[model samples]
Target: MTTTLAWIDYLIMLIYLAFVLGIGFALKKFMKTSEDFFLSGRSIPAWVAGLAFISANLGAQEVIGMAASGAKYGIATSHFYWLGAIPAMVFVGIFMMPFYYGSRAHSVPEYLRLRFDEKTRGLNAITFAAMTVLSSGISMLAMAKLIVVLHIFDAPFASLGLSSEWIFHASIVLSAVIVLGYVYLGGLTSAIYNEVLQFFLIVAGFLPLVLLGLKNVGGWDGLRHSLPTGFTHAWVGMSQASTNPLGVEVFGLAMGLGFVLSFGYWCTDFLVVQRAMAADSMTSARRTPLIAAIPKMFFPFLVIMPGLIAIALPAVQEAAAQPGKAATATSWPSKGLIPAEAEKDPKTGEMVPKYLRQAGSDEPLLDANGQKQYAYDYNLAIPNMLLHYFPTGMLGLGLTALLASFMSGMAGNITAFNTVGTYDIYKAYINRSGTDRHYIWIGQLATLFGTIVSIAAAYAAAQFNNIMDALQLVFGFVNAPLFATFLLGMFWKRTTGHGAFFGLLSGTAAAAIFQSLTLPAGAGPGIKGGWLANLHTFPSEMAQNFWLAIFAWTTCFLVTIAVSLFTKAREDKDLVGLVYSLTEKPREDHLSWYKRPLALGIVVLIMTAALNLIFY
Candidate 1:
């Protein structure tokens, strides 16, 4: 699994580290006030904020997991982008940005307070702050694990007579310090600027890999011939749950991933919203997500093609020479470009194969050939692909880009955590009367605190990965119902705080109950669900996740409506600029058609739809 890196690679990483820190120090003069530190003084341009928005999400999962999914699910992996994110990004821009920008709320939970009441905001803020910290920590853990897995620090550790185990700890500290240094120095501005840098770094890093991969597989035509029938088509055999690699039918895919999960994260999650909120103007805020949607539409080609090539390489083709051979241990991971888990040979003191295990169980997953499945190490799909194509210097660039992704994710979470902690938690509850300067100091302190906590969380993640995985799902349960609260509170002027609060609780409960009752087809009792009664079986764990979101959204939506019918509504005059009906629509007449949010949004949707059709 480990590859030797040349001096050029180390130099590239060192250069990248220098620039990341340099950006933070360069922006230090701008952090005079609290607004500048936390909100970037709302001075960011639309294009800049737009790239930062998507890049904020370009963490380990976006870069690594998506590529893994690309290999696992084939072209259908684009659905996570084209189907799930594009619409939600557009919706947040034209429809949702007005209130977020106009209401002058400092954060999403603060908007909750303005729209509903203190208790609702308090609940969201507390949970969000906690989740943000945990998420950041999870990012930290992922970065460290990647470092250990890649053996990036093996030489240094060995030189120092240090145990290999120190690599994980060192990776964690190295990431935390870098993330903390920048965010602490320039706050969101530094994070945003660095995110923009990271975005380009990733693109620069991956574009060539994709090209090389395409060439290696003899281009798209060869790819098509080499891959399985459904692998090349995104929408083929998608009607039935059993037909496609995704395992979800169209209704479930469209409604669950497309609507509930997508809208919940994009429309309501403060992490990405914070990027837009930092934009300099109302027009810029609305345009932020719209601009992000442009590149977002075609990202699969840039980020996913390598995975396809990884799967359709020459070795895999040879393995399938016997018709209907299907993937086996030898060819499953493209001739061990993706490695199987390894153990030590006790007699020879050499490493041996450690068969990958099924989720939530001790049993190793076996393919149709009765051979143990290769490489549950999907995390390395993109990494190994880069190693396959890139030479010494370019390999350094690619790995640096990988490192950039980890930093971007960490910085994004930490920035959101500091802002919410300062504005929603501290200002609202802890120090309601602090001066702007005092709060700015607190904000800086909060950044440091958030980083430390994240580091701790990273260690916790290392100690109890499965528990951390479950905690992430638990947070998903919390967020699954959130869009309902946002949707109703914005559109309906009659929604009450009590309705929003209890609706959220009920939705979370519904998600938990649903998860407990259903299990994925081959999964066992545990985080993969079915602990309650196993009343229902889902086609896959992804399907279970989607359905859980669907149930949660529906429960919250209906409960909020019912509760609001008997609860007191805020007066129309008091709701101005906050409620959609009560507020005047944002005017775009002054700007050109392409410059307008609606016009750009329409174009984005059209392009996205066209992609779906072409791929379908």
Candidate 2:
């Protein structure tokens, strides 16, 4: 039987799509030139830019990933949101925002060119473009996978004796096409405006899920009773062997990677930086990230709390009782088993024996090996919870919010790609003589091309084990070193381009080696049996991976600084300007109330200490 979607659900989604397209069409007036298209005519207000920045950054992966982590690691996972991201946002607001805004660079790589040389700028631009495309593709693919699992659309083909896999493939293609169309129409302006709408929808849809889920789980007392000892204890279930491969301690691996990756993402990524750059003035740009930081402080409640509540649900408990059956039903194609036809409910038109359907009050769920499936797949937990808990009409709103996340993220990536392609690549190398109109056309073409490539990449990324883990693994290798280079460049002027380049390369190489050699296959020995392995297996592995990257970055920085001191300096005019600019005093009058860093610092300290205390 085919489940009929409620008209209200369809109407809500249609309205959202229309709203997004309307913004894109309206923003065309601002798109006469490439600058306007890619950077919102460089006149976006601080508040809009800030909202867009948060919206773009909070994609489906983040929403889903945080919930997943909460299920896997408990409240400790909150550290990533609070201690890791918030401080980085504040740092960018106070320090990095001014530098980027003052430079008036269209992209981060353009800043690199002004700070270093053309080669560095070109390399950074290419790397940023490549990473952005890959990440966006993976994110889109994951979103599609989630929708498929939720059975968002009718698998009519399945009912017609066709495979549901085709349904999955179609969903991905259709979503990508819709996203690319609007992004090509209007660049950052459309993206930012759409993001504003998405931000509200996501928050509105998510909060109820948390509250309702908690109530269903018997509130705080029931949750505590149902969960294992240490479930509420921030650090109760954490295992170094499972979560961290290098056996690094929590502070060393988690905190270090959090610090490095957060800075790299918030400070260095053009997706976020473009928003700051689009602000009207340096002060506005500076305040944008700071304003964004405040909202971020509350994200753990929205993202992490739901998953924690999910674990206590009676449905999840029933599923846990029948491991073998549950595993067989829900298992993906990777397990080398052909999927049996789904059984349908005659009245509801929903699949009756859907793998993730809630267990009857009397039935018990089983695990893969015919035992109780006590531990859930963290990745599947959130989707399973949502599908079971939400009613049909509310389900439409939830789905729209989820799609909004995907669209906002995709839009952000498209805008960043277009900005770098137009300003950094086309203007810098292909056609220095091109007019603003010419560059705008180039950006549109680039956006279209990027979307196509991202869709393909998304399909390929499906082969990976977990979406969030794949993204983090990629970031660990590529972004960790960039963090080092940016840090050195900002604080240590003596650092040379050779240092920056080599540091990034070394860091990436080290991270790759650690990932390959140290990360165990499935469940392997806790790191090569050594004296260090006994103390803590997981953190040690994580630490090894993180530190290797740090070591590579630091080694590169030192070598470059030492080499540059002995070697002759480049006669680059922009490099000279960068050096001079560092020495100038701040323009005092332009400073707003937030210009003082003390309040931000206090907030950062409180959040950091709270996270640590909770985890400890």
State the C-alpha lDDT per candidate.
Answer: 0.87, 0.69
Candidate 2, residues 1-616, lDDT tens digits: the string is 1223476877888898888888778877767877788888788888888888898888767888888777766666666766568778888887666667777777899888877778878878887887778778877887887666555565446557877767778878877777787787878888888888898999888888888877877876777777665546554434443443223455554546667667767888889989888887777787787777767777777888777776665443322212123443343221101122244556877543334322334233555776432334566555555555677788778878888888888878878887897788878998899877888888889998888888878877777546546555666577766767777776667767776666666677765654545432223432222222222233344455555555555555565666667655555454543543454534656455445444554665586567657545
RMSD of each: 4.1, 7.2
Candidate 1: how many backbone clashes? 0
Q: What range of 10 consecutive residues in model 1 has the weakest lDDT sum?
A: 317-326
lDDT of 2 at 435: 75
TM per candidate = 0.94, 0.82
Q: Compute the lDDT of residue 453 as modeled in candidate 2.
A: 83
**Candidate 2 Cα lDDT to native:** 0.69
What TM-score quantifies how close candidate 2 is to the native fold? 0.82
Model 2 regions more than 4 Å off: 1-4, 155-166, 235-248, 316-375, 463-475, 520-544, 570-583, 588-616
Candidate 1 off by > 4 Å: 156-163, 315-336, 343-375
Candidate 1 residues 127-181, lDDT tens each? Answer: 8999988988988888887776666778778888999977888888889999999
Residue 258 local lDDT, model 2: 66
lDDT of 2 at 566: 67
